[model samples]
Target: MTLTFIQNIGGGFLIIMLLFSLIYFLLWVYCVIDVIRSNFKDQNMKLIWIVILLFAHIIGPLVYLVLGKNTKVGY
Candidate 1:
């Protein structure tokens, strides 16, 4: 009985892990696409952002969401 309970718990954990991984992948893809389509005068800047998003993994998207915007506004 105890073994069966343990197996069930492990299966639940695996499902949770898979779900989290799918979410992570989706978030990463979203970041990549946004970066590619973003308006930046300098093409090099776009490339740099793409590299950062690809190499920085989880932190990349969070960083982009926080700091990857044009701060200027109309006068």
Candidate 2:
């Protein structure tokens, strides 16, 4: 009985870890795509932010999304 309980617990932990990893990976992909699609007047600025996001991990991407430049309309 104890052995079966241990196995069940271990399996549950592994499943949770797998799900978390998939969510993280999807978030990373979305961040990259959103940065690419955003309308920053300066291409350099966009590229710079993308690179920072890719190399800096989760926090880096979040920072760029919140603070990066958006499109500027000139009249």
Candidate 3:
């Protein structure tokens, strides 16, 4: 009964969270792949960014996108 009421009323919240989670995972994977495929002036940057993404889950990708993306040197 309670579950049904919550589902009826608050189901939008669950859907929104699910969507956000999917988008977030995609962003993380994209960033990780970009880091691998990119070359930086600093060779260790790739390893460091991968470690950051591996351990820093939430903040790592955002930081990489904002700060590190521009640091790529070559194709």
Name the candidate, 1 or 3, with the larger lDDT value. 3
lDDT of each: 0.78, 0.72, 0.89
Error of 3 at 57 (Å): 0.6
For residue 18, what is the lDDT in candidate 1?
92
Clashing pairs in 1: none
lDDT tens digits, residues 1-75, model 3?
A: 988877687767888989999999999999999999889988998999999999999899999988896677852
Candidate achieving the largest TM-score: 3
Query: Could you give candidate 2's per-residue lDDT for residues 27-63 as a string of tens digits?
Result: 7788788777776676677788778887888687567
Q: Rank by lDDT, descending?
A: 3, 1, 2
TM-score of 2: 0.64
Every model's Cα RMSD, please?
Answer: 5.2, 5.6, 3.3
What is the Cα-based lDDT of residue 22 in candidate 2? 94
Which one wins by lDDT: 1 or 2? Answer: 1
Model 2 off-target regions past 4 Å? 1-9, 69-75
lDDT of 1 at 40: 71
Q: What is the lDDT of residue 53 in candidate 2?
A: 82
What TM-score does each of the candidates earn? 0.73, 0.64, 0.82
